[model samples]
Target chain A: MQEKQKPYAYAKSLELFARAAAVIPEGIYGHQNPAFVLPGACPYFADRAQGGHFWDVDGNQYIDFQCGYGPVVLGHNHPEVEDAVREQMAKGSCFNHPTRLMVDLAERLTSLIPAADWAAFAKNGSDVTTWAIRIAREYTGREKIVMARGAYHGAHAWCTAYPGGVLDDEKKHILSMRWNRLDDLENLADGHKDRIAGIILTPYHHPTYAAQEMPAGGFWEGVRKICDREGIVLIVDDIRACFRLDVRCSPHYFNIDPDILCVAKAMANGHPISAAMGRKNFRESAEAVFFAGTFWSSPAPMAAALKTLSILESTDAIPKMERLGRKLKTGLEELGQKHGFRVTASGPAALPYLTFDDDPDLYHIQAFSRHMISRGIFLHPHHNWFICAAHTDEDIDYTLETADEVFPEVRKEMES
Target chain B: MDEILRASLFLKAVLPLMEDLVDFDTIAASAISDKRLILQFEVKNGPSSHLRIEGGKIRHGIGMHQSPDIRLTFKKPELLNRMFDGEDVRPGLRKGFFHLLFLIREFPKLAERLQYYLEGDGKKAVDEKTKNFQVRIGLHAMLGGMATVASDDASLRSIADETPFGTLLVRILPDGPFGTFTKLSHNGGYIFESTFNQPVRHANAVMEFAGPDAAKKLIDGALNAVTAIGLGQEIKIRGLLPLIDKASIFLYRFGKIMGV
Candidate 1:
């Protein structure tokens, strides 16, 4: 890691952020909000991006492990996804009727995912997740929906992680079960009885400022059994960990069958499209549910999804991403040990988060992340980091190399 | 606006923050350092609380104070709330006339000073001392007001009804000015407990400002939470963050109550 003569600065990024603040809400809002990362220490805006890396407005380049917060699984601007997008755009994008590419993409998903018998398209993860919930409610004629506590399904009023501007009535029917706690889910189902419409859960718990949690042993089996007994619909929100875990969807990796599966990020490799695929029996309910976005029939992202899925299947992208994620995790853990830090690298290899023992407020990790950002490595301090297929051995090595220098400084700061 | 809730807020939350004013504000401290005054606010058929200013310290007592130097009695909770809002709806005097004069003249100044800090009036071109007091008073008022509103307001209570039972800890790092928002399961609402300085413990969620400067910026709304949290160790939030996230809505509502 080359140390700059002067301290690193984001002159242009800050200027643009200030300008954005005057006109925009929170300067940048939602998950993409720069507030989620180290603002002054990290770049607030990107100038351009290519495979595995991006350049900030200040001309500082970074190995971006965030992968656009999980949408860019194949990495930024993959030629195949780009080319397919271009060809479809030339044929025009939004249309009154569904395009052939939409059917092609749906067919591709239904073929790949064992649980998906039919698929519907949307413009975002929230669109499909909300649609899935509504479809389940319509199918069961029940009002209650159970979800894992702290699991983010979407930004909809009923399921939003934040409470700002949301009403109590909007969430009265929504109940929460602790993640990996099969008994909690079972108890919720028992308590709700015939009123449970659906149970929506992220494939894995990837909460912010915390270590990600995989389903404990028999967790999925217990959930399936309970849902089966209660006649409750099980909806898997695989939006964040979709293709990164498996090309066939995360349920396939976990060996759990779900009634409906929603996917968005990494589906089209950065294209703005999402889908909800359900079992054949629920197709009628899915149809009955009113879910429409004007651009749902957009052909370009459909083509992009088609190509992205193909590339994911043809190449060893998934395995490569898993391997790279393992290397980064292993290397980071080793560096933590060498520097007298108790670091735990959590979640599946494809998508990982790092947490320090005894640092509940994440001071050490934030400090480490600040050091990493100044060294031009973009590992988020709070959120789970995505591993894209485009990240190379060199990128991982450089990241480790940067960490080797950073851990000691962070350790020193902890002591001070 | 529920006048009863507003009255509860004034009696339970807002007036009690005078303790913080004396504890943090040097001028307010010196003004009351030599005084021994016990003033009681009695809202007929509603809430009753008292403020005790004794020897450089202020203590708040709930209900009647046994023997108060002066008692200001409101005909209804609404008049008390109206008086808090600076209306000419004076309370009926129940006791000492000189103490009533103190309440008439000097008490408004304390309330005005508290308003100056809580309402974001002293954010610009202020010295470190003013900023420190502002942050201290603002944090207490915000959290205290949140607890009061969560318990007293019907709309806010519904929001609290769904909030998962947990404790949220908020503090500035390396000591001084810390508070905890604990959602009690039995009550189905949150209670905020803060002290001048104490080590945080047993919190389900924690939001820590790195220093007084960061705390000041966030409390004053000069730096939005997003930017403050993003400032790399400036504001570190961890544990059950959804607990904090949910409670933050009340904190936002507290801002609205303060007219920020």
Candidate 2:
């Protein structure tokens, strides 16, 4: 028997969102759109965050599991990362020329990533991803690029999941293969032949509103073989799972060698920075491709990234996140069973998601998410929930306790 | 905008909406309650459609009727399109001069009323009944418009051709209106086989608006489709989302074509 808890209210957040809606498009846009959450059941805005927790505008506190959709890996407003950012900001961020910090970060990435001999900086995952595609095209002197269907590389025209404002011309040269299907990849590569410039894929499939999938056995090996034989570049878009999977990068974690790698999200612990790292063979092609943004040379994020990487390397945060994530997943599944619901927790422990076994319409999971949010744990209903290094055993215990109370309520409501 | 697509939408989508308009709107239904006539409008060597009005009900379909009481012929597709677009273009009457005159005199009022409701102009004081009528028609129009454009427009036809065989079910929840668009076949083309007012047992995608207000906001531009969908429970889009996403883009292009 568990005591029912009062749901967190969002009067202030709603008030602010109403004001925001009049002026801003969709009140909050992109991945953080309030509509992505159970709007009335979840807070629409946040006031402040620290470590693994954040307080909403209405002053209700939550154990943050979303981690700003994979960006706040080290944690929100981490003191060390912030201090590094401040130290760089003291000497100005953007400048007339490339900062020394850029070279240092590049060198650090090139040294750390086994396949990367050089790195170029950018401001977003999309910037580097689109740039990496161009580099592959330049290197292979081809037009078509193959990607796993439903894999999100970025908001760029070539890979945006949404169809708004995108032209068929932009996607004409792009091809798709089903994830974890070596047959699909082989067929696409065989079908397109020398016309394919590259095959871009994430370390694992993390499509929204569905269970995440790891690379099946020999899937990566088959892809690597196909790329080598077909003269196509192998690009690993590790933006969502970069540091969370491995300190080196996801490719290193999975033991797959890629010619080009795009890293972002957790790169600078929430700072705006991304890097496209590539092998020495594509160096001239990378330079030949025109890729530049106004904020590409900014130094503050580079400093933060350097410190973040240092902390990731020097500490046992990666293993800690994994251990905590495992505990949470096990506890959640057990609780779901105890309450007569079959829950399936999928993906790597560090970046986990759970869905009801037979709830394709997602009604049960959505009700479950609303219940969890009511209990002050911020797990997204649609996307995979991130487990930051800041999360601890106490947070996991509290989450499990809340889910224990929630699972019954969700089951009862859904059954009704 | 392509003239053929526009003409197709006007013939297939817009004209078809008159059925729901008469069924839902008391004024539109009463206006023709005593009337029973078949009015056919055809573009010379191009698209043609006829509307049947009987027993206070309106039903429309593509191509000519066997024996229409009234028939009006347009020299070209643009003439019919411009006529629907509110230009004062008159077509040559081939039959039933009195019936054609009756349509010419009575049809504009019905069209204006339909536009007022679909656009949610807020010019007139709206009751719950009228508002519901507006939402029902808006959903039908957008979906019918999408099906028409997806089948006819070159861009959307290519998309439709690429779209795998599947069905998209859209409904205003807790009762009332429903629309289902099915990609009947790959090269066989698409059909907006709307099982309106009926719940589909299964579909590749199901986009449910929580209530009429949510549906109204989405249809009237008070809320964007993506934003409404983001509201999770307010608007639930589940299952094969790519089909819904592509259908939304077709609906968007249809709205652009309609200039509303």
Candidate whose DockQ is highest: 1
User: Which segments of candidate 2 are over 4 A away from where they belong?
Assistant: A1-5, B23-50, B62-77, B88-132, B146-195, B199-248
Inter-residue clash pairs, candidate 2: A35-B230, A35-B231
Task: Compute the lDDT of residue A297 as modeled in candidate 1.
Answer: 82
Tens digits of lDDT, candidate 1, A1-416: 33343235788887787777777887888877765665567788899999999888998888899988999999899998899899988888877898888778888889999999999999888999999999999999999999987688888999886556887889899998889998898788878889999999988899888899988888998899999999999999999999888899899999989999999999999989999999999999988988777889898988988989999999999999999999999999999999888999999998999999878756788888888888888889989999999999989998898899999999888689
Interface RMSD of each: 4.4, 4.1
For candidate 1 chain B, the 10 contiguous residues with the lowest summed lDDT are B189-198
- In the range A26-51, model 2's lDDT, one tens digit per residue, is 77887777655665678888899999
- Model 2's TM-score against the true structure: 0.88
TM-score of chain B of each: 0.83, 0.90
lDDT string for model 1 (B1-260, tens) is 56777787778767878887887767677667777989989988878899998888998866789989988899898899778877778789898787755776677877776777776554367778777777776666666777776666666654666565666778877765787776775555344443334455577767788888988877767777765554445777765554666677777776666555
* DockQ in order: 0.32, 0.31
What do the candidate models score in CA lDDT, each in turn?
A: 0.82, 0.84
TM-score of chain A of each: 0.98, 0.97
